[model samples]
Target: MASFLGDHELVKTLLSSGALPNIQNYEGNSPVFASANFSNNKILKLLLDNGGDPNLLLTQEYVYNSPLMIAAINENIEGVRLLLEAGADCNYRNQLGNSARKIGEASLNLELKALLMACDNPT
Candidate 1:
């Protein structure tokens, strides 16, 4: 809930106490994945730095949204960048066969599309 609330201090406190950053609730929404939809990247960064898996999926029925997808769909560019830098799978598609790259393209976010493209052709 700290992540959803964007409470950075509380999130850090919990992580410091050995809370699993990847632990998802019954909704299949982990702190890491849920943070992607937030307006800020602070919680996402903290979680990622504390061993949160950027590629963790929201396992809701007929849905599979990775942190990258959540970020992309919500237009959280920084969150998307953080997830990408953390080695998120750009090719991963949800149940609807939608990918972050596709979301970027569909949403007309050039920078997002560029980022995904860059990952596809790393130096």
Candidate 2:
């Protein structure tokens, strides 16, 4: 609900009130993962900036995707950049042995692929 709203201030207030940023919904998805899945760049940024764990793995039925993988799979370039900047593991692979770069390639999202490659290099 709140995750899809793009209410950054409300989210901040909630976090200040001690709301757990990593709380999973009924379907076992956290707000950060939901923001990534929905391609909500602002929400994703807010979550990440407010201490959402970039490395938090999804334990739901979707079982193998990280937030970076999901953002790359969905072709959300900004989301990918944000996650990468927040120190997400660029080489992190899911059960399918796919890293963000591979996911971006499979999705044909050149921008994200390039970003992941750049992060991987970082020299």
Candidate 3:
């Protein structure tokens, strides 16, 4: 759970020592999910740089949310931008049949909503 605590340096060191970024907790939440949920931009960036897959779906608890969805729901504009720039699927649908765009809209976060719209029409 150190990674979940937003210790960017420690998390990076652990990852460098071969700590699997894909490892999940008891509830099956990945590091990426934790970082997104907590709005930890530093941890998120470190994880992304270290091969954390933003597109990885939560298969256990909270299956209705994705890393992108979580970021959007949390109004994490930078996190959402990072994930999108990292090639996360902007149109991914979760168990609730909602995409990141929908989550952003539902969040009522102007910045996140704008980011999602930009993602939806990149160019």
Candidate 4:
């Protein structure tokens, strides 16, 4: 709920109350994963800091399932950067075998594409 609503206060309360950040819905959308669909970098960071698995792919049929992929699709560059800096597998493929780079390419955001490219071959 907090993640979906981008309610940082509630998220902090839940985390303090021992809520598991990795808990997912029936559709395999974890709080962290759900947060990635939006540009709420703070929420995503909170989840990640609370032990959310950045690499948890969505198991829903036909869903991209990866946080990084979702971030790319949403054109959430900051979200993508946060996930990558937190150790998300940039090379991780989704249900369609598309990596974050491929997803970003499809988004047509040259900056995002460049970011992924740089990540794939960091200098």
Candidate 5:
């Protein structure tokens, strides 16, 4: 909830209060996933800083893939950057055969596509 709302302070307090940043809901979506889907980089950073997994995958049937895929699909440059820095697999393919680079290429943003390609070999 807080993560989806981009409430950085609330998320921080929750984390400080022992909130599990990586706890996925019934839909296999975690706080990091919510933050990335919502394009809230601050909340994403808060979650990642508190042990969120950037490469966490959605278990069920969700249109989105990993955080990197969501960020890339949404053309969220900073989110993609942060996720990549946190070791997000740019080549990660979901059950639907979706990958960050694939969606990025499908999008109209050439710059984002270029970034995805640049980080093809993510560390």
Candidate 6:
């Protein structure tokens, strides 16, 4: 997958070729999800700009797989920023009832936790 590889050009080519931005892999992970998990902010933005859902949830068994969740759990600041700016729900909880903020706090990423909180209640 281009997202996993951080191949911006390949992703652009695929999208131009009509590949669905929201297409999921066998694990139910979309390109946006892959980009976020890998901290590929450029690719994530590409997908989002092409109609990818920042808040799209994967139907996996126990994984909380939204873009914001993935980015926060991975301590990916840029990915988190992009998703938040794209209107991702910072308060959205997954199957474990863990929001991005909770995950960041659990991981001891205080900056990420603070960022999520700020994005959740921007003024």
Best by TM-score: 1
Please provide TM-scores, in order, for all candidate models, with all chains considered together.
Answer: 0.92, 0.85, 0.89, 0.89, 0.90, 0.88
4 or 5, which is superior by TM-score? 5
When sorted by TM-score, best at the front, the candidate numbers are 1, 5, 4, 3, 6, 2
- The residue pairs in collision within model 6 are none
- lDDT of candidate 2 at residue 117, scale 0 to 100: 73
**Could you arrange the candidates by lDDT from highest to lowest?**
1, 5, 6, 4, 3, 2
**Cα misplacement distance, residue 109 of candidate 3 (Å):** 2.1
Q: Show pairs that collide, candidate 5.
A: none
Q: For model 4, which pairs clash?
A: 58-65
C-alpha-based local distance difference test score of model 4: 0.83
* lDDT of candidate 3 over 1-123, digit per residue (tens): 867888888898898899988787777788998999899998998899889998887777565567988888778889999899888887888777888977766666788878887775332
Residue 56, candidate 5: alpha-carbon lDDT:
88
Give residue 65's error in model 3 in angstroms: 1.8
Of 3 and 6, which scores higher on TM-score?
3
Model 2 per-residue lDDT tens digits across residues 1-123: 688676777777888898888887777778888888888888788788878988787877656578888888778888888888888887777777777766766665567667877766332
Instruction: List model 4 lDDT by residue over 1-123, tens digit each.
Output: 789998988998999999999987888778888889877789899989989888888877866568988888888989999899888887777656788877766657888988887775232
Instruction: Between candidates 2 and 4, name the one with more favorable lDDT.
Output: 4
Query: What RMSD value applies to candidate 2?
Result: 2.6
Query: Compared with the true structure, what per-residue lDDT tens digits does model 5 show for residues 1-123?
Result: 889788899999999999999998898888888888888999998789889999988665765589898888778888998898888888888878878878877878888888888875643
lDDT of 6 by residue, 13-99 (tens): 999999999888777888888899888888999999998889887766756568898888789999998888888988787777788
